[model samples]
Target: MKKLCSVMAGCAVLAMLPLTAFAYPIDVQKQLNGLSIDYNSYDTDNDIASIQVNNYGSTDAICRVVFNNGPESPRTRTIEVPAGKHKNATAKFTRTIIKMRINLTCTPK
Candidate 1:
């Protein structure tokens, strides 16, 4: 019975492995070509903060965003913008901060 319980638990853990997104391989830089992606604007009003990207090209765009503030450690993300559409990547701080700088580059993979 103990052996059966351990086997069942192991199987259950393996069964749920597919729920993780990092389980597979991903290539980032090669995926950013043939599209228009830019940091259009940013707004940090109230408790909310977001970075917006616009894609004007016929194809979708993927970009890597690096956000930095003097006091806090820098953060980054891989953002996807649909063709002719835009997207916003967001972040939150424990308390209100002064300023945040946004930088973006093409995504590969």
Candidate 2:
């Protein structure tokens, strides 16, 4: 009876482990025109924050990117790159924002 009770307690503890020790990956890709913009969250203690943008298209593209902190204001930058290349850009923010806006323009190969 003692061994059976111990085994049941051990099984209960193992079942709770999955609830606390679980991780989920996020996918942040949206398509526009002929380009697929892939974005991911980044963390930094410095004053500037950088985002990785990948061009998943067949042709060269130019990205008109905008970073907003809230309803207050936003910063913009343009990045020109060929296909299968990744670009990095930094945006200085006074406060954290809810979402980011990424606009792209595809150029002929």
Candidate 3:
């Protein structure tokens, strides 16, 4: 009876392990679109901005970010991340245009 109970308990623990180990899916779309930039105080000589994105998914994801109304030409880049986690990227420019906006796209495999 004791051995049987021990074996059953072990099996139960093993089943629960997979459930807890599962990782959430990365939602890059929401992070990219939800980004907000504040330009309340305007200065002609100096302008700075930053953006961050977090990835939560079962697998790694690639992110492509684009910045519009930046001081320089528009920029795009891709990043890779692992499962059950998140990563962030930043963009900076000296020039500030009215209603600055950033667009991001994430792809997971």
- Best-fitting candidate, scored by TM-score: 1
Model 3 superposed RMSD (Cα): 17.3
Q: 109, model 2: CA deviation in Å?
A: 7.6
**Cα displacement (Å) at residue 27, model 3:** 17
Stretches off by above 4 angstroms in model 3 are 1-46
Going through the candidates in the order shown, the clash numbers are 9, 0, 4
In angstroms, the error of model 3 at 96 is 2.7
The RMSD (Cα, Å) of candidate 2 is 6.6
Worst 10 residues of 3 by lDDT: 37-46
lDDT of 2 by residue, 38-84 (tens): 65545332233456777777677776656544465667777775788
Best by lDDT: 1
Rate residue 63 of model 3 by lDDT: 63
- Candidates' C-alpha lDDT: 0.61, 0.57, 0.49
**Candidate 1 minimal-lDDT segment of 10 residues:** 22-31
